[model samples]
Target: MTQDRPIVIGAGLAGLMTALHLAPMPVLVLARAPLGEAAASAWAQGGVAAAVGPDDDPARHLQDTLAAGDGLCDAAIAARILGAAPDTIAALLRRGVAFDRAGDGRFALGLEAAHSRHRILHAAGDGTGAEIMRALIAAVRRTPSITVLEHTEARRLLVEDGRIRGVLVAGPHGAMTLPAGRVVLASGGIGGLFAHTTNPPQAWGQGLLLAARAGAALADLEFVQFHPTALATGTDPLPLISEAVRGEGALLIDETGSRFLADSPGAELGPRDVVARGIFRHLAAGHQVFLDARQALGDRFAKRFPAIAAACRDAGLDPATQPIPVTPAAHFHMGGVAVDAVGRSSVAGLWACGETASTGLHGANRLASNSLLEAATCACWVAGDVAATPAVRLRPLAEGRLPPLPDPAVVRPILWRHVGLLRDAEGLRAALRALLPLAAGGGPASDPATLGLMLAVAALRREESRGAHARSDFPTHGAGRARRLTLNLAEAMQAAAGLADPVVLRA
Candidate 1:
C-alpha cells in the first residue's frame, strides 16, 4: 500500500521470516492461499537441523552436510549457513517457537538421514514446521509495518533495463500491477511437476518460472531429491513419513519381511537418494516395501510421532500395529535460481530465498532436516541485503491482460514417466520433444512445461549419475570433480530446439 515498500512474495516460512526481519521498514507479503495452507513448510515434519546437541559442533554439522551433498556442496557457503544455526534457533525461540525439550530442560534433539549427530530440534513431536509457522504467522500479524495480502499470486516479474520494476499479480478481485523496485521470491519448489510428491501440489516452481522468464540464472536444475518413504495410499500429493521415523530405528522391509537394505551402509538411515533408489528397484522387482516400526517404536509410535500417527489413522492403518506401506516421491529440489551469499539473483533488485534460490548449500543432494535450517538462516541475510540496497525511482506501469493461470496436470505424467527417479538418454530425449512445443505455446501448461523442459535439458546434458540426478545409461559419477550446472531460459530453449526432434518413447 505504501510507495517504494519492498514486496515479499509467498507467505511461507522464508517469506514471512524475511518480512519479519525487515522490521519497521515496512514490507508487503503476498499469499496465494490463506496463511496456513499451500505451503510445504507447514507439512514439514523432520524439524530444523542445528548443532545444538552437546556432541555436535558447526564443523561436524558442515561435514555431514557436505557428505550428504555428495561432493557438490560449496564448502564456504555451507559453512557460513551452518555456522548460523545456533543463532537462528535462538531467533526462532525469541519469536515464540517452542521446540520440544528433554526431561532435563535441554532441547530434544532427533536424528535424520545422513547426519551423524542428533542435531534436529523438533516441536510438538513431529509437527516442527507447523509449530514454527504458527509462531511466525502470529509474529507477522503482530508486526505493524508488515502488510499481508492473502489470496493474491504473482503472475510475473516486470523487469525493465535488466532490473526489477514491478510485479503483475492476480488477486481475489482481478489482476493488477504493483510497482516496486525490490521483490523477494520465496515461492517454493517444483515438486508438483511430478505425478507423486510429498510437496504441496501447488508447489510447482512458480518462483523459478518468475525468475527464469525474467532472465535470472538457474543452477543444478537436474538434481531433485526423492524421499523414499511417502505413504503409498494413492494420494495425489503423498504424505511424507519423516526420516526421523527411520532415525528412531524403523526398518525398511518387504512384504516377505526381508530387510533389503540391511547390507547397505546406514541402511534405513542412508542418504535419501540412495535409500530412494533401493526402494525404487525393489518396487520395480514387484516387491512391496514398508517401514516396519512395530518393533522399534510399537505403541510408542503414537507418542513420538503424533502427527504421523494421525495421518496413519486417517488412512485406515495404525503405525503401531501394522507396517506402513511406502514408496518414493519427489520431495525437494536441490537446485534453483542461482544466488550469491546475500540471496541477490543475477537480475538486480530481485532476490530469491528458501526453496527458490540455489545458494550452493544443498548442492546435488540435501541432507535431511537442512531445508528448514537453510530457510531460517538465509531469510535473515536476504532481508538485510534487501534493506541495505538503495531504492530506485519508480516509473508508471501500463495495464495488460493477465496470463492464464498455470496448470501442472499435463506436465506431471510426462515428467514422472520420463524424468522421474531413474532417467536415460532415450527418455530424456522423448521428454524434450513433448515439452518443447508446450513451452513455446500460449497455454496454461506453458509455465510448467518450460520449467520441465529446462530440467530435461539439464538432465540430458549431465551425462552421469550423481546425487539425485541418476542416469541409467551412465550409472557412475563422472571422471572429474563435479561442477554446478547453470542455465537460463534461452539456453534451455536453444538446447531443447536441437534435441526436440522425433524420438521413440520408451515402452
Candidate 2:
C-alpha cells in the first residue's frame, strides 16, 4: 500500500540481483517457494560466459552469440550484455562467490557447444548456478532493506486506470494485496509446460501469462532451447548432464555405440539445437541414445563434476565406468514478456529480466552462460530506471475472472509431444487445437496453454529451420532477413485459433 518501496515477484537471479542493486531503498521480494530452491538460476551448471581470457574479449563473445542466434539476434543488445560480462563477473566475485581458477590465478573456463572459446567461468566444477545463487541469496538475506516473502505466489496484478498499482499474492492465510508503485516480473521460463525439462517442473510460464494479462508485449515465443543431454530417467524435471561433460571431450552415441555428432556442422561442439535434433532423429528411429563421456572424464568425473556425479549415482548410473543415457529436454526459453534495453515492458511500472524477459540478447538461440550475465546486468539497469520513476498512488481493483487452474499432468505431455525439439505444420496445428481450449482463460492451464499456443502458432508460421525452432515442413531458410514478432495474449490467441495473423492484429 505504499509507493516508496517496490515489489519484486519471483526470487530468482533477476529478482535477487534487482533487490541487491536497489540497496538502501526498501523492497519486497516474493517467491512461490524458498528463495534458493525455487529458481532455475540455481540449476545452471555451465557457468557464466565472459571474455576474461587472454585470447577472448566481448567483441568475440558477441560475434559467437550472433552466430549461434542464427541471424536473429539484436546486435545492439548482444553487445551491451556481453560487453558488461567481465564487470558482472567482478561484482559476483566481490559478493564472495567462488569461481574455479587455474594454478596461475586465471579463472578456469570450460567450452560448451556453440561458443568459440573457453570463456565460461565455472564454480565448483559444474555447480556454477548453485554457487552464484548461494552467494546472491546470502547477500540478499543480509540486506536490511530487502524483505523476502517465502512461499508467496503472485497471482494477479492490481492495475488501476492505466498503471499497475501492486500485486495480489496467495499466501498461507490466502489472498492478500501488496501495494507498490513499481512491480518487477522476474519469474522464470515455461519449462514445466513440457513433460521433460531441465528446469524445475513448477516453472509454468506464469510470468509470461501474468505479463500478457496485463497487456505486455511478448516476442520470439517460438524459440525454446532444448539442452541435448538431460539424464533420461523417468523423473519430472529431468536431471541435466551439463554440456561441460561434452566440453570435457564426451561424445554423443546411439544404442549401437556409434558416434553421430561427427556428421553435424559443429560436430560435438555444434549449437544446442543441432545436437538435440541429432539425438532426436536417432531416438525417433527406436535407437537408444547415450552420452559417451566415460573415456574422456574417466575416474576424474567425480572430482571434476561433483553435482553431476551425485546425480548419476542417485540415478543408478556410474559416470566414470559407463555411458549416461541422455535425451534432449526443455531447457532455456529464448522468448518471453518482451522487455526494452533497460528492462521496461509495454506496461508502465513493470519490468522483466532473466529468462522471463526476451531482451534480444539471446535472439533465436542463447549462448551458454549469457542468461546469468543478462540477469545481472539488466537487473542493475532496471533498478536504476525504477529509481527515477515518480511514485503513484495505489488503487486496488476488484477481483475478476478467478478460475480453476489446469493440472500440469494434462498440459505437459501434450506440449512435449507436439512442440518439443522438432515440429511440423500438422503437429503444431494439432497442438493448437488441444491447447487453445485449455488456455481459454479462467483456469490454471490458462497461462501455460496461452504460452504454448503462442509458441505453436509462431512455430507454424516460421515454416523454416532457424536456430532452435526447426520445422520439418519448411526445411530451408528461404531467404530474406529474419523478422521479430511482438504480440499480446489476445493477438496470440487469435493466431492460435486461426482467426488472424499477429501482424494484422498489430495493424
Candidate 3:
C-alpha cells in the first residue's frame, strides 16, 4: 500500500510517543493485537523512574543506573537519559497521565530494587504502565494524523538501497506491504524466547530479528536480564509478582519457611541478577522458594498488589496467609538493534526505541523502573530527529517478496535449554548445533529467535563470564575491555559453527 506517511511497528508507549512527537504527519501503527492486549508496556506495574522528588537529583539517578548496570553502562548515555527525565515527565503529564500524588499534591514517588532514592513515579497503586499507555492511546486515537491497524504483525522491514522504505505486515485481512517515508520499530523485548517471562507472549524479540536480517547493527545481545521473583504458580511461562510487592515489604523464602534473601547483604533490595541467581541456586539444591508477604502487608497485600493477589488466588493460594512460590524468568534484553542517542539505527530512514533498541542506557542490567523512562525519552528524541530532517518520498519496491518468520515452537526449547539463565559452553554449543539446521532449512525465520541465537552466539564467543552472561566454566570476566558487538546472520552463523561440538568446560 503506497502512502505518504510513516509506519511504526508496535503501538506501545514508545511507538505512540514517537507518533505524537511527529504529529500532523500521517502515521500508521501496526499492532499484532488490540491496544493494551499484546503490548507488554501495559503490563508494567512499577512506575517510571526519574528524579522527580526533592531529595533526588538527575546525577544521583544516573549514578544508580550505571551502578546497577554492573560496569557496562555508558556514562554519557546514562547522564543524557537522566537529564531528559523532567521533560519526559512533563510530556506524559501534558498527555493527561495521572501520576500518584501526596497529600500536598506533589508527585508521590516509590522505591524499587537497586535504587539509591525514592524516584519511581506511580499511578493507580500498581497500574502505572497501563495508565500511561491509556493516556497515550487516547491522544493517538484523537489525532487524525495517526491510524492504528490492530491485529497486524510486522513481518519484516522493506529495505531498499540500504535504507528502510516501509514494512511487510501480516494482519487478519492478509499479508500486505505498507510503504512509508520512514520506519520505526518499537516491538518490545525477547521475553517470549524463554519458557518463562513477565512480558506478554508477543514480546518474542521479532524487532531484533527483523533488524538483524535487514543488516542493522545490534549491540549487547549477550546481556539478557532475568527478573528475580516471578510468581511460580506452575502457570505457563509464569506470571510476574511485581517488584513493587517486595518494595512493599514481601520477603523471599526457601521451602522450609526460611527467609533466604534476608541473610544476603541488602536482603530483598539486592540487584535483580544477584537475587535471581541466588534463587536459582537455592532451587537447584532441592529447596523450594517463596515470597512471604502475609506478615508485613497482611490484608493490605491483596489491595496493594491486586494482580499478584489474583494470580495467587487463581493458583489456589492466599498471599495473606502463606508465602507465594517464585522463580527467575527471562525478563528483558539490554541489547537489541544498536541505536544512537537520537534513536536512529545504523540503517538510514530507520529508527528504534523502547526494548527493541539497545541505546546503551541499560548496560549489563537495567535499573528497576528506568525502562518506561527510556521508552518515553528515546521516542521523543527520534520524533524530533525525524521532524528536523527533510522529507523524501520512498520509491516503490519489487512487491510480494517477504522475509521468513521463524517458528516459535522450534526455537523456544533450544533457547530455554541452552541459552537460559545458567548457561555454559556445552549447552550453548549444543543449542548452536541444534539451531543451525533450522536456520539453514529456509523456513520463515523468526526475527526474535534469530536475535536470541545471535546473542547466544555472542555469549559463546566471549568464552568468559561477565554480568548477566555468566558461564560456569569461565567463572571470571574476560580481559577484553567491555565493548559493543554487531553481527549479521552469516557472521554469527560462522562463529557458531567454529565452536567445538559442545565446547568442553572445566570445573
Candidate maximizing TM-score: 1
lDDT of 1 by residue, 74-111 (tens): 99999999999999999999999999999999999999
Q: Would you list the rank order by TM-score, best first? A: 1, 2, 3
Better of 1 and 2 by TM-score: 1
The stretch of ten residues in a row with the least summed lDDT in candidate 1 is 498-507
Q: lDDT per residue, candidate 2, 1-507, as tens digits?
A: 445479888888899999999887888999989889879999989989999999998999999999999889999988998998989998999887999999998899888878888999999898888998999999998999999999888877766666787787787777777777698899899888898898987797888878888888889888999999999998887999988899999988887888877877978778888888888888989999988878998999999999999999999999899999999999999999888899999998988888999999988888877888899888989988887787776655454443344356677888899988888877877888888888785576776787788777777767577888987877778466386767777777777766333343222
List clashing residue pairs in candidate 3: 205-448, 209-447, 404-445, 405-444, 405-445, 405-446, 406-445, 406-446
Q: Least lDDT summed over 10 consecutive residues: which range in candidate 2?
A: 498-507
Between candidates 1 and 3, name the one with more favorable TM-score: 1
- RMSD for each model, in Å, please? 2.3, 2.0, 2.4
How do the predictions measure up, each by TM-score?
Answer: 0.98, 0.96, 0.95
Better candidate by lDDT, 1 or 3: 1
Off by over 4 Å in 1: 500-507
lDDT of 3 at 425: 79
Model 3 alpha-carbon drift over 4 Å, by segment: 1-4, 402-406, 444-448, 501-507
Off by over 4 Å in 2: 396-406, 499-507
- Expressed as tens digits, the lDDT of each residue in 256-286 for candidate 3 is 7888778786788888877888898899899
Considering summed lDDT, which 10 consecutive residues are worst modelled in model 3? Answer: 498-507
